[model samples]
Target: MSKTEAAARLAVRKTYKLYIGGAFPRSESGRSYPVTSSKGEFLANASKASRKDARDAVSAARKAFGGWSGATAYNRGQILYRIAEMLEGRRAQFVAELAEAGTKKAGDVVDAAIDRLVWYAGWSDKITSVAGAANPVAGPYFNISSPEPTGVVAVIAPDEPLLGLVSVIAPVIVTGNTCVVVASERAPLPSITLAEVLATSDLPGGVVNVLTGSVKEIAPWLAAHMDVNAVDLTGVADEDLAITCEQAAAENLKRVLRPAAADWYADPGLKRMTAFLETKTVWHPTGV
Candidate 1:
């Protein structure tokens, strides 16, 4: 075969799809936008999620919350570790995406993201111990407090793209909270590819639904969504936009992780996990 024939045979384009309910589907709106590399090279067309798409994602997340939250901590830990393992296997793909998105150290970023997942996987069972406590009261009553998942969460993926995306997502699901994430507007290819990773992993359907589009257009719907339990605005770099979303979240009393500057490569600690948790205290009569 001639070189031209071989090159034509090898050309296979990838169609980026929206991930919802463990299925990859074209956007309900049937809209897509061009994705370009940092040097302005055309990569692919990413699904442009709409308001209805956001609603669908929320519905999927809410539907999955019960089973995910009910699963044993050990089971959740195992699943998270599995995701880390899968990511390890896809290191080359993620590195390529990160490099295309203009990251300087793509390989190091991918390594950090995998380590971040493993770190959070280890914390799956430990968070309860660290965040829960047995309290002493004046009366002869036993009081104990524990943390629980906050149901469906909406996440705005950070602009740092690959590593930032992983940093925000791992902590939420590790504790059994399902999420609908809006990928970085400019660099969404990696996030959708990560969705492909999640779909193949041990994670159940709707545990993590990802949307690719303009955050300005999609974020308000998620923030104000009545069914959504919380909103993580880690990706909203604009203070005004973040404030607007926060106000909308107030309508439903949603747990809001306000926008702030973050170093994605730094140790995230327990803050992200704790943000979407609800503390419940129980008291019982002793010696009735």
Candidate 2:
């Protein structure tokens, strides 16, 4: 803007809030941290989620789990697809955020993220066909096993703000598990923006709660949280911190996915979705 244009109007800054239970709210601790761009330029202030915030997120996830998991797999797939459509509409915004966050091939990353969502959406209903099985028994019994969502999961997103976040989140939710996801600390703007998209989508509130803050401070609390059913340590780089979260998770026997070096651009298979799934087998008398 020119001098007169700049003088006439001031930019309205956006308040980057946490997405908990489908609403945007300030952190419970009332702390906000300056999120800087790739070159140390101020982007905006993101909520510095505290332990209390983490607990709230977990509660929200648990509350939504029953409804989300009970919904038909096809319904979940439709919601995920809707999210992808919304993200496509907001491509320019996501591209800008990724560029500011110093991601190379920003547009490509955004496209991959969108495609990843679509991929997982397609898998939602089909996963049962592939994972569920019928076993032949010598007796007159029909034995069948099927997969089910493991309940609320806590995810530490990888540092690739957009693609990595989508890569982890889509798999978890598409499989019917509600989740409390900690955005990548290095760059959370894109993740929060994605939360906005989610808010408008058909996805129910609390099905996917987003928290942006220090992973070290928030993750341990979630790991030890008795209500959380699983903890994904994909973004924890510190070995010691990962260990601490693992130990805490073990206390409740929460399903744990250890930190792994992942290529966000590569094809992510069924493993991520399977990690938090539990199998149930039933035996029925034939022709009873």
Candidate 3:
């Protein structure tokens, strides 16, 4: 082919769709919105997820919860590490997307996100030992307390996009909880690509469902969903919005992690992992 022929060939653009139940699907509402680069250039059209899509994601998460929570911690760690490996392989793509989204230090951000995944992956098996312990009782009985996953989680991903999304998500699932994540509205492209990484990383379907579009439109339905066990409001910068979610969560006594300022680059420790964990104490008599 000549240079002119090559130049005349039309570019095939990628369609950014929502990742749900291990499959990429168009928004149920059949809506899409333009995602623009930092320079106000048209990048691509991303699925505009609606309430029905959020509900579908929740259903997917709930369905996958039992099997994921039952998987061996060691296995979970391996899967998370696999995600990091796939992400590292696609480093250039993520960097370019973040740059287009106006993320400064995009390369460092992507690196930090990868390192964070590895960090949480290493913690998968070790966390139980740290978060659980034996208790002293006044009887000849063995009493112990252990951490368990808090069922399905609904997450509002932070505006920081990639790093923050990875930060919140890695910990939640590493501990064996499944989640439906609301990708950053301002920069949904990276989240879509990350979903591709998740789908190919040996992670089970429905373990994570990524929703892209307006948070205001989709978050309330998640907050009020009876089947949702927990809600992370880390991405809600609006105080009133956070309060509304908290109030709605109260209806079912859903575990709510209220909005708070976080430095995505700083040490996250075990809080994010622990936030969605529930303690179950069991007692057994020693003597027969």
Candidate 4:
């Protein structure tokens, strides 16, 4: 076998693990599902994360939120750029996974996926300056408002696999917010592999966690999760499911982004950044 083929064979046998609190742990439920390669061949077992696993992922995100959000914009930008670099290095793996997933335009999807990461990486620092501004409230006091991270974010990744997953996740983390992502139901193996990329990309543990399982089973828990500050329904295709998730988010006044049927591979501009931000107001008395 060629060196590339040898590496591919070895990766196929690697047992995938869930990243929690910056460490790999077998699912608390001890469950796994079969992962397949591009050729309809079984590759490995992906962790079948349970409710307990979802909750654990949330806890990890919550714990890591402070440090991640508190990081300087420059540092966050660097980390995001690092992820793009890692993704570039592993382009072949993603291409292989996409082929296995049977995408009709695997080449286009791969290009879009890598391109999406780079787009978001550059936005890591610039978003704050663009979306966030010093608001001037008419008063004899110093008033300033700027955008801040919305705590922990829960996202339902797009079912298109490569473009879909990157579109949702890149925006969530670029602004210093951590996320618990549920991968596409039909094609989850790519999401699992992406998680591996993050694990090695210098991202803090829990800053971006991935879970592969039934969204019908886990998404509700996230919507109602008090610790989760926001919800992105970008992946919910069913109208009823979207409605139910919206209702759950309203429970805690969680920020919600309704799903849109956008062509994800097309240019996704500032919309993603504006969707997940919170405005924070700072006030002080001027006539002290």
lDDT tens per residue, model 4, 1-288: 566554434332566777677776778898888867557687677788899988999999999899999988778878877877887888888887788888877878877888888888888778877876676778877877688888899998888887888889888888888999988877888887888778888888999888887888889999999889899998888888888999999999999987568798678878777778888888887885
Tens digits of per-residue lDDT for model 2, 1-288: 566554556678888999999999999999999999999999899999989888899999999999999999999999999999999999999999899999989999999999999999999999988989998889999899999999999999999998999999998999899999999998988889999999999999999999999999989999999999999999999999999999999999999998469998787988999998999999989883
User: Model 3, which residues run further than 4 Å from truth?
Assistant: 1-9
Runs in model 2 lying further than 4 Å from the true structure: 1-8
lDDT of 1 by residue, 4-105 (tens): 554445668889999999998889999999999999999999999989899999999999999999999999999989988999999998988899999899
RMSD to truth, every model: 1.7, 1.7, 1.7, 3.9
TM value for model 2? 0.97
**lDDT assessment of candidate 3:** 0.94
Global lDDT scores for all candidate models: 0.92, 0.93, 0.94, 0.83
My TM-score estimates for the predictions, one after another, are 0.96, 0.97, 0.97, 0.90
lDDT of 2 at 13: 81
Tell me how candidate 1 scores on lDDT.
Answer: 0.92
Q: Show the lowest summed lDDT stretch of 10 residues, model 2.
A: 1-10
C-alpha lDDT of residue 145 in model 2: 92
Displacement of the residue 235 alpha carbon in candidate 4, Å: 1.3
lDDT pick, better of 1 and 4:
1
Error of 2 at 29 (Å): 0.6
